[model samples]
Target chain A: MSELLNTLMQDARVWQGHRHNKTTTPSESTGYQLLDNQLGGIGWPRGALSECLVDQPGIGEIHLLLPLMQRLTGTGKTVFWLNPPHTPYAPALAREGINLDQVVMIQTGDGGDFLWTLENCLRSPVTGLVMAWPGKLATRDIRRLQLASESGSNVCVLFRERRYTDQNSPAALRLELTPGDHQDLKINVIKRRGSWPGQRCSLAMAHRADLAFRETPQVVQGPWHQSRR
Target chain B: MLWLYLHFPHLLLDHIRRDRQDQRPLVIVEGTGQHVLQACPEARNRGVQTGMRLKTAVTLAPELGIVRAQPEQDARILEDQARWLYRYAAHITLVSPDGLLAEIGSLQKLYGGLPAVWQTVEQALDEHRLTAWAATGHTPLAARLIARAGKGECTGDRGHILRTLETMSLATAEFDAKTCTRLQRLGLNTLGEVFALPAPELARRLSPEILAHIQKIRGTRPDPQAPWQPPHSFRQQADFVQEIEHSQGLLFPLQRMLSELEDDLCWRQQDTDSLHLILQHRHEEDTRLRIRTSGPEHRADGFLNLIRLRLEQQPLRAPVVALVLSVKRFIGREAPAGQDLLGKSQDLNEAWHTLISRLQARLGDHALKRLSPQEDHRPERAWSASEVQSKHKPRLTNPEHLPRRPLWLLQGPQPLTEPPTAWFSGPERISGGWWDGERVHRDYYIAQLRSGQLAWVFRDVREGWFIHGWFG
Candidate 1:
C-alpha cells in the first residue's frame, strides 16, 4: 500500500507538468504594438480561455474584442456570442473591421444553457471562437471549458464576468480591467499558465475619431523606473 | 361591310397547346353561383358566352372545361409584361386584360414610321404567344373602335380610319341607344356621317358627349390616360450564369447584392423594415425567404447576420438560378449627431437602435419584441409589442414606473416548483384582465437567491408560483 501511494505521488507530478506546459498557439500581432508587447507579444493568447473583468461600461472591453473578432472573422471563421447581456452596436463593430456577418449571437435563458451552447460551438471546426457573458460561473464549470478549449485547437472561448466571484478558476488567463484615472485604463493580471502573475499596468486610451475601436495603449512611463524613483 | 370581330378568346389554349389536356374548350368562371364572369375564346366558339347560364353551357357543350379566373394573378402577369414592353416603347398603357395601347407618336421616328411601330408591337406580342390588332387615329375612341373591328391587315392612315368608321356598324361604334336614335334622326347611319357634321352644329344638335366622341375619333383632343407606376420598393437581383446547388456558392453573389442594397439605403437616408430574398429555380417557380427586422435598419452587417441566421436554420429548397433582395418598407433614419464634451453622455435613441439590431440578429423579428406602454394604469396590460409601421416610438408617459419594471420579462408566467428564502421580499399583488380569458391574480417578489443573484418571481392565488425574470 505504501509503494502504491509512492507511485501515485510520482504520477501526480507528471500531470502537474502537463498542465504547466499549456502554451498558447502562435497568433498574429494585434497591430497595437505596445499593447501586443505587454500581452506576451502575441494576440489574446490563442486556443485558451481568457477572462476579461470590467467594472465600468465603455472603458476598453469592446475595443479589445474588436481586433480579436476582426482577425477571426477576417479569416472566414465563425464567432459565436453566447448570451451577451449588453447589446452590441452593429455600426460601431463594422467600423472596427469585424465582419459582423460572421458573428452569431445566441441569447440563452439561463447560464446553464449558455455554457452548453458554448461547448457545442467549440466542438465545430468551422467555429473560430465563442464569447459568453455568464453573470457568475463556478470554478468546475471553468475547468470543463478549459479542457474543451484545449481539445478544440481552432477555437477559443472568452467569459466576461459581470460580478466578482471568489472560487478558484482554471482559466488560462484572468485579467481584471478597471477604468483609469484619466483617458486611460488599468489592467491587472490575476493568473497566467506557466508564467508569474504580471504587475498592474497603466496606459493611455484614446478613441479613434473615424473608427470605432479605441487606440492601443501607449506607455507614458516605464513601470519599473516610475516606481523606483 | 360584314365586320367579323373574331376575338380569338382562346389565346391561352394556343399557348398551352403542348399541355393538350388543358386545351378542351375551357371557360374562366369567377365567383360563385349565378354571377358568371368570363368565357375563353374556345368557349365562345362553342356558343358558351359570358353571362350565359352555367347549366346551359354545360348542356350545350358537354366537353367544355372550366377554370377560375384570378384577376390578381392576371394583373401581376400583365404588369410584368408591361415592364418588358417599356424597353420597346417609352409609354405603354394596359387597355384591358389582353389589350395594350402604346403611344407610337414619338416611336414613329425611331422605328422609321407608324407601320414600323405597329410591327414592333406585333413582334412583341408574338414573343409572348399573344396576337393584338392595333389601329392609330386622331382620337383614342376612333382608334379603339378600329382596333376592336379586327382589321389587323389594314394600315391605319387618315383615309383608312375614315373608311373604317364609314363601314363600321352602329353596334360596333360603342354608342348608347339614345345617342344612336339621335344620330339616326340626324340621318347619320355611320361614324363618318357624325364626323362630316360641323363641330358647332354637331354640338348644338347633340350633347357635348356626342360631339366629344366625334372629336376623339377625329384626333382633335388629347387622349388622356393614367400610366401604370411600379411599386415604391428597392429590389437588388443577381442572375447566375450557371445554377448553384450549394449555399456557399450563393454567398458571394448575395453579399454583392446586399452591399448594393446597403448603398441604396444609405443614399436614400432610410432604413428597411423587412427584406425578402427571392430564389428563382432553374425550372420551378421562385421561392421567397423573408428576413424582417425588429426595428428599421440600414447597416449591412446587421442585415447580413440576420440572413446568415435564417439560412443556417432553413436551407434552400432547390438549386437557385437567380437571387433577388427586395425591401418592402423604408423608414427615415435619424442617427445621433456628435455632442459636446460637457453635455449628457448617453444618447438613448442610439443605444435603443443598437439593442434592437443586436436582438434582431440573434432572435428573429418575431422573437425580439418591444413593450410599448399603452394608455392603461394596470401594470399587466401597460405595455404591448409595437406594431409594424413607419414610426414606432414607445409611449412611456410614466417614467417613474419604468425604472421599477424589469427590462426582460417572460412572455408568459413560468410555473415554479417551490418558493421562499431569506433573500425573497414581500409579494406585490397585481390582478387584472377580467374581460379577457387570461385573468391574473399574482403576487410578484424581488428575490435574491442563495448565490446572491437577484430574480423576479411571482405567486398566483390558484396556479401557485412562477419565476419571471432576472436582474443582471
Candidate 2:
C-alpha cells in the first residue's frame, strides 16, 4: 500500500491538500529579502523556467539579477546570455563581482537560432544560468525550454515584453515588473507553483543614486562657448 | 628469430568487391590489361583462371567485371593494410604489392604464444573480409616463400619448418628458371636433395647471386628488413562503381572511413580538430568540405554528425564518383579531468565541449563568443568578444569602489531628441581619449525620461546630447 501511494504521489496530476504549505521545489535565494518574502520565503525556483515581463528596458531589471549572477559565477559555473537587446557591458559585470571568464554571450542572426541557442544553453550541465530575451516564442517552444531546464537542472530566466502577459506560459514562476515611484521597482507575482498568485510586492532600487555625481559642475564662460553661440 | 609473413592473393579484388553489393564475377587484370592477375571466387567458379588472356576470360565469364591494376595504387592499398596491422604488431615491414612482413619473435610473450598471435591476425582478416596466406619461419625469406607457396602453417619449430621446406619441389623454391634447370640437371629433384650436396662444391658450381639466395633462405646470411612507419597525416579514399547522385548516399562510405580514423587516432593516443573531405565529380571540379571541432576530438560519432550537418547545409552540386577524407593536424590527448575524489563533477568539461561543437556546427563559428573585460576606460574598448577558449585562466581582480555602470551599452551612442522630465543627478564631467584623435569631452547624467525610462545621457562639449546605455 505504501509503494502504491509513493507511485501515485510521483504523478503530476496527484494533488494532496496537506502538502500545500510544504514547498518541495528546489530553490535558490534571490538575494533580496523583501522579494524572498514575496516568494513565500522559497526564493527563485531552480531547475525550471521563470518568466519576467518588463515594462521598459531600464528601471533596475538587471539589478534584480546581480546577486544571483554573483553567486553562480563565484562558484565557477558558466552563465550564458542569448540574444540580449544590447551589449552586456563587461566592466559593469566585472564590477558587480561576476567572473568575466565564466560569462558567454551568444548572438543569433535569426529566430531559429535564438530558440535553438536558448534550448541548448539550458540543456547543458555545465551552464548554471541561461538568460535570454527571446522576441517571440511559440507555446510549444516555451514548453520545450521548460522540459530542457528540468532535465539539465539549471536555472532559466526568459525576459519578454509586458505585451506577452496575457499569453499563458508554462513557466514555474511568472512575475511582472514596472517602474515605481522614487526610483524603485514594483514587482507583482503573477504565478508560482503550489502558492497563491497575485501577490504584489515592491523593492527599493534607490541604491543607484551613488552612481551619479553628487556635486554639480560649475561652468565658466569661455571664448569657444561665445563663438559657438 | 621467428618471423611472420602475410601474402594477400587478391587484395585489390577484395577491396573493390566489398564496396558493392553485387556478387557478380570480378577480376583484376595486369597493368598491360591483357592477362588476368587475380580473380574473385565467382570468376574462379566460372573457370576463368589467373594468367588467362582477357579475351578468353571474358568468353568464359561474360558478366565478369575487369579493373586494370595500377602498381602505385596497389602499393598504397598495401600500406593501408599495414596501418591496420600496426595495431597488432609494432614492427611491421611492408612487402609491396600484396604482402606484410612482421617481426613477431619479440611479441610472442606479449600475446601469450605464437598461436594466439596468429589467431588474432586471422580474426582481424576475417572481420575485414580479406583472404591471406600466413606462415611463420626462422627467416624472413623463408616465411615469404612458404606463404607464397601456399604451404603456410603456424609453427615456430625449426626442425618442423625445415622438414616441410625439404619436401617442397624445386619449382616453388623461388629460384630462377636457369638455376632450377641447373639443379634438376644435377639430379637434385627437391630442396632437401639439393641441400645434401657439399656446400663448397655447390658454391663453386652456382653463381654468386644464386648462391647468396640459397644462403639467405637457409638462414646463413642476415637479411634485415626496413620497418614501415605510420605516416604523420591520415588520408583514405573510396571509389564507387555507381555514381552517387545524392549527398546522403555518401554517408554510408563516410561512416566506415570515419570509424577507421577513430581506430587510427586511438592507436596514436591523439586527437584531431579538423577533417578535410573531397567529393570528386565526373565532369565538375571537386567539392571540398572542411569540418572543424572546437577542441580535440576522436570519437567517430561526433565527427560523423558534424559532417552530416555540413553536407545538409551545402549539398553536392553534381554526382560524385569518389570521396576522400584527410586529417593533417593531430593534437596530443590529455588525461580526462573529471570525477574528483568527491565525484561531484562527472565529465562536465566533456559535455561542455560537445555542446559547443554541436552548436557551432549548425550555427556559424562566429555566432558564439566569450566576453572578457580589458583595461580601457572607454566602454567599447573595455570589452572584447573572442572565440571560446579550451583552458580556463585566472581572472584579473576588478578595481574596488567603481562607479555604477549600465548593464546594457548600445553598440553606438544614439542622439537624444527630447530633454528629460526630471534629473536625479547630473553634471559629472568625463573627458578622455585625447591621445587618440577621437576625443570625448562630455558631462554625463542620470535622468528620467518622459516615458519613465531611466537613461544614461551625456552632453558633448561641442555637440548635442546623446544617450549611451540602458540599465537593463
Candidate 3:
C-alpha cells in the first residue's frame, strides 16, 4: 500500500509540473542582448499581456515594436491591431519587413466593445498575436484579457499605454520606453514573471537598414525610481 | 465628306445680351459660381476683356449687364444638336461644344460628295437659327483649318485643297507666336509656302512640330484622331408624338424599351448593374429615373421586374412624355473553362446577375454600393464605393503585426464619457509626431479580463483611459 501511494504521488507531481510549466517558463526573450542579459536571459512571456509606456511622442516606440511584430508575423502568424488611436503609416512598417497586408486594423471606439472584439479575435485559430491601444482599461477588463490569453496558447497580447496607470495591475511584463537626447532609446523592464523585477537598459534605435540588434557596450541606469538597482 | 466647325464668340454673353434689354453691355461669367470668365463681343467692344475684375468691368461699362454662364445647359444643348446630326452621318465626333466632325467619307456618294454635304450641314445649322462654316478635306486637320478661317469650299485636286489652305491666317493654323515668327523669317508666310519646303529642310529650320503639321495638311502623314466609340451597353429610348399626363401612360413605352435592352444585353454576353432612364417631356425639363443593382448583373426579365417593383413603390413625380433606358455599369461574361464530367463549371455569373437584377427592380441603381478596401490604417477612410473600372487590391504586409481590431468602425471618433483604468500586460508604447503639433503620447496596453476576454486599452497623459480595440 505504501509503494502504491508513492507511485501515485510521483504521477501527480509530474502532471502538476507539466500543467504549470508554460506559465512559469519564459518561452522567448525580447531578443535584446544587453537588456535580456540584465533581466536573467529570459524573454517577454508569451500568452500574456505586456504594456509599454511612452513618455512623449516620436521617441522610438514604434521602432522598438518593429522587431517583435516581425518575429511573430514572419512565421506566417496574423497580427490583429485593435483600434490604434493614431494612424500608422503603412509604408514605413513595410520598410521594416513587416507585411502591412497581414496586419488587420480594427477601430473600436469604447473600451467595452473593444474588449469584446479582442476576445473574439483571440478565440479564433488564425490569430497569433493581438496589439491594441487600450488607454486606461478597467482592472476587470485587464483581468479578462489575461485569462483569455492564458486559455489561447501561443497568443501574445501587447497593449500600448499612453500614460502611467496603476502599477499594481496583473501583467506578465510591463515596459516603459523613453526618448534620449542622443540617438538612443531608454527602456525599463518594470515587471516580469519568474524573473528579476525592475530591470532597466538603454539601447540605440536600430537604423532602417539594420534590422538585427547590434550589441552596444554602453549601459545606463534606469530613469524610473521604481526600477531595481 | 464635309465637317462643320463653329466658333461662337461669347455665345453665352451674346444670348444674355439679346434677351436682357439692359442699357449696360452684359457679359456672361464662367467661374466657380463666383467669378467672371469672359465678356460678350459687345462688352469687349465697350473695353471689357476676359479676366477683367467684375467691379472693373462695371466701372468701365456701368450699364454692362452681367449674366452667369450655364455650362451644363450649353453642353446638353450641344449634345442634342450632335444627336440630330447623327442621322446625316453615322460617325459624328464633337470636337468642342460648337464644333463637330462627321466621317462622311462613305456618305459622300449618297449626298453628292463634299459640296452637297457642306450645304446640308449649313442648312441644318440654319434651321436651328445657328450659323457655322463647313469644309471638306482628305484629313480632319485640313478641314478644321478651312472651317475655322471661314474660307470658302475647295474641291477637285489635292493642289486645290492645298491652295485653299494657303489663304488661311497664321492664327488659323493654331501655331504659337515663336513658330509663326520662325515661319515668317523663313519666308513661309502661307500654307502653300510651308508646303513647298522640302520635308528635311523644313524639319531642321523650323520645329519638327511645324513639319508634322505641314505633312498632315499635305496628306504625306496620317492625321491621328481618337474617334468616339459609343458605349457597348444599351440605352432604351422612346419618342412620343404627344406628351402624356400620367405615369401609367409612360409604362408601355418603358416596358418595350426594357425588353429591347434586355435582348441586347443577352446578345452581347453582358449584364448591367445600373440603368439610366430619361423621360423627355414637351416644353419641360427631362425627368431622369436611375435604377441600381444590388450586385453585378444583366438580364431583361430581371431588369423589368426591378423597374416594375420600383415604379409600384414610388409614383412618378412628373408627367412623362417619352421613356429612355440606358445601362451605365456592365459586367462581361466570364470565359468558359473546360468542364468536368457534368459539363459545368462553378461560376457565380448567372447567380450574381439574377441577384443584381432583383435588387435593381426593388431599389434604384444609386441605392446599391460595393465597398472596396483602401490602403489606409485609418478605419473611417479604409473603404470606398467600387468604381466602374476595378482598382488594384491593396498590398498587404507579409510580417503581420496582429493588433486587436474591431470589424465595424464608426465614421468618426466617438467621444468617451470617462477615462479608463490602465491595467495592462504588454509594454508596447508608441509615441510619434513631436515635430508636428498633432502629437500622440500613449502607452498601449494589451490587458486580459477575468472573463477570459482580451482588450486593447491605452493611457493618454492628458486624457485618462480609453479602449481602442478588443481581441476575440
Best by DockQ: 2
Decoy 2 TM-score against native: 0.85
Interface RMSD, candidates in the order listed: 16.9, 4.9, 13.5
The DockQ-based order of candidates, best leading, equals: 2, 1, 3
lDDT of 1 by residue, B9-79 (tens): 43333322222323466655665645345665667788887788788888877887655455554554455
RMSD of 1: 16.1
lDDT of each: 0.59, 0.83, 0.58
Rank order (by lDDT, best first): 2, 1, 3
Candidate with better lDDT, 2 vs 3: 2
Model 1 chain B TM at 0.46
> lDDT at A147 for candidate 2?
88
